[model samples]
Target: MDHKRDKEAVLHLYNKILPPLAEKIYQNLTEVTPLFDDFHLEKVVDTWTKDRNTTSEKEISLENGNVQQMGLRLRLNGFQAAGAQTFDLSKDLVFLLEYSTYTVGPDKNTRWLEKPYLESWTSKEMEETASRWCEEIIDEITQKLQTL
Candidate 1:
């Protein structure tokens, strides 16, 4: 696998997901409802890793069929700000959380290799799964980010 292309995939995910997640978190912060409280918190994406797995059967035919590549995994870590200890009402007041997830999709080169028998089905299923998971993760993280 080309390292440069792999690196680009990682960066692509970071650029695609982080901004919306951060924006929702920021809006949640400003609302300051009963669910929201003032606290010092910082969020950062630790890093991403290359995914070698390809979901496309076409790509699989070219190489090993059983492998699933995790193109990039984004680990979001955060810590509660200082002088905000009062927010620690719960003993488990976790100031830090790391949400790590990966993205997988067929690139242009791999598109032609997809097995005609299962291309659309596999693609749709994977896409739906990714969408649901990402939504759940973003919702959970946004809630936590606001609380912190």
Candidate 2:
């Protein structure tokens, strides 16, 4: 397989699929938690051959709250080229979600109360499957965050 072709295919997946999905997940999270209003979900695509990865991140800092800082990271991986005449779904794709929180200190420094509350991965084949997987993951994350 041509490395260039494979790289292009990966880039295509990043540009075409991941961003919209990330946005949808972000939207869902925002709907469930008003704290999400203080932060923005950022979708980053790193196509560098040696470090090919896609990530979604959100960080928020609040002045006088139990949760002074919250960070969320989602990594997208396991991309593979489909066989001829096969549907191009993110079947091989995996999403790793990590959640972090910090507390405000007396000196106005943020202390790591809980670095990661949740860490999970989701894998699904086909467009619909992948979408449902993402939605479920987002729902879980939202539920987890509400307790924070």
Candidate 3:
């Protein structure tokens, strides 16, 4: 199997999965569509989420040409939602979501976000994509809380 092709396919799959998952949350929950204005949802919420976390350089090799690998980690804390009386988000309801996407293939060349890379996937892009998905899930939960 071609490693580069595999990596690209993974990223593309994520790009496809995230938006629909978010939309599903919204459509099913119904109450969330009003949290942000259409403009706010499209621009601010989406764009801000894009900035929530970033890829960090894990390591680099000098002896051979290896660009290293990295990923993003994020935690949303102290989120409160309104139920019938206002849902209180706490550590238990804390929803711990961890995201990671890695390059899978033979040789060091099969690394995501590696410079002079063989794979077409970038860790940064993958991180952002994962975050977007998480945000959508959170938004769905938030709406559920509001109506409860």
Candidate 4:
């Protein structure tokens, strides 16, 4: 069986999902409540990476159709000024997080522990599953970002 098709299909699913995910994360950060009176959420740096932040050399490689790693690196920083009425660009790194996804298993919870190999699902099925998982991840990440 040609795994190339499966890899292509999986990559396609991620390609469609990543942009909106990044946008949602950015949007959430924009709405964050400052922890201090003068604290500001000045700059948000978000980028999509094919590399796995968890690994050393295997940072970027799609081994088999299932063992793929992709993530969004988020850097949000702000500054606290003495009595600033308005917040402007300042570098006071508040939080940095990378939300990663692994297409390793059928169950979301057990995905990391289980060995990864692409399931032979149709494109539509894969799309639905990937969308659902991304939604869950987005919600979780958004909440965490807001809380920070």
**What is the lDDT ranking, best to worst?**
4, 1, 2, 3
Which stretches of candidate 4 lie above 4 Å from their native place?
1-6, 33-67, 81-148
Per-residue C-alpha lDDT of model 1 across residues 53-121, encoded as one tens digit per residue: 533333221122222232223233333445432332211111111123233232213321222111123
C-alpha TM-scores of all predictions: 0.28, 0.32, 0.26, 0.32
Tell me, by lDDT, which candidate is best: 4
lDDT of 2 by residue, 66-132 (tens): 1221222343222122332211111112322122221211122323121122211233223343345
Number of clashes in every candidate structure?
8, 0, 7, 0
lDDT of each: 0.33, 0.32, 0.32, 0.36
Better of 1 and 4 by lDDT: 4
* Global Cα lDDT for candidate 3: 0.32
**Least lDDT summed over 10 consecutive residues: which range in candidate 4?**
89-98
What digit string (tens of lDDT, one per residue) describes model 4 on residues 1-148? Answer: 3233234544543455445544444444443324223422222222334334345443232333233334343323343334533332222211112122234322323342221223333455445544444454446544544554
Show model 3 residue runs off by greater than 4 Å: 1-10, 31-84, 88-148
